[model samples]
Target: MKRFAGMLLVAVGVAGCVSNPGVVKTGPSTYMVSRQGKTGFAGIAGLRAKAMGDANTFCAQQGKQAQMTNTSQSSGMPILGNFPRADIEFTCVAMGAE
Candidate 1:
């Protein structure tokens, strides 16, 4: 029983550490990134920061800049199994291009 309990704890820890999926191309030059809070204390601000960082990295990789189009976040009740989350929509544009 102790071993089983330990295993379960480990599993839960791993699940909480799960990372956000990478950015997705939604349309021409437009992309989206999303992140879920890892724990009850994790706030939407943290999730949004992570997502924005990812978007910037992705655009940089393409030799472009990230121009945010829209952003949304939900501060769900983590106690009820609804964790905070954030989604960011952006477009990859040239350094000087609108």
Candidate 2:
């Protein structure tokens, strides 16, 4: 029972560390997508991809294509394991009227 409880606690902690990537409107025509994870260069790239993918998906749902304008990353608190993060900014480009 003690072992099971410890495992459960570990799982919960890991779950909390999982990044939930998503998009948010930052301007009338621009949107921002972001994600955070514990990784180095590859992880940062993956997060950037995830952010861009989310932006593309968001624009697609609005009958448009993502026109990525900029990309960024931040090395989060090193004391907290350097949780790297990535963000992408984009505007929705028209794909013709639906």
Best by TM-score: 1
Model 1 agreement with the true structure over 1-98: per-residue lDDT tens digits: 99989977875776567567889989977899999876667778878888999998998998998989999987546654356789999998888788
**Stretches of model 1 off by over 4 angstroms after superposition:** 1-19
Q: For model 1, what is the error of residue 43's alpha carbon versus the real structure, in angstroms, after optimal superposition?
A: 2.0
The RMSD of every model to the true structure, in order and in angstroms, is: 3.7, 5.5
Instruction: For residue 27, give model 2's deviation from the true position in Å.
Output: 1.1
TM-score of every model versus the real structure: 0.75, 0.69
Candidate 1 TM-score, true structure as reference: 0.75
> What is candidate 2's lDDT per residue for 1-98, written digit by digit as tens?
99989977765675467675478889899888888774333477887888888888898998899988999888555333356778898999888633
**In model 1, what is the error at residue 53, expressed in angstroms?**
0.8
**Top-scoring candidate (lDDT):** 1
Q: Give the Å shift of residue 2 in candidate 2.
A: 18
lDDT score, candidate 2, position 87: 83
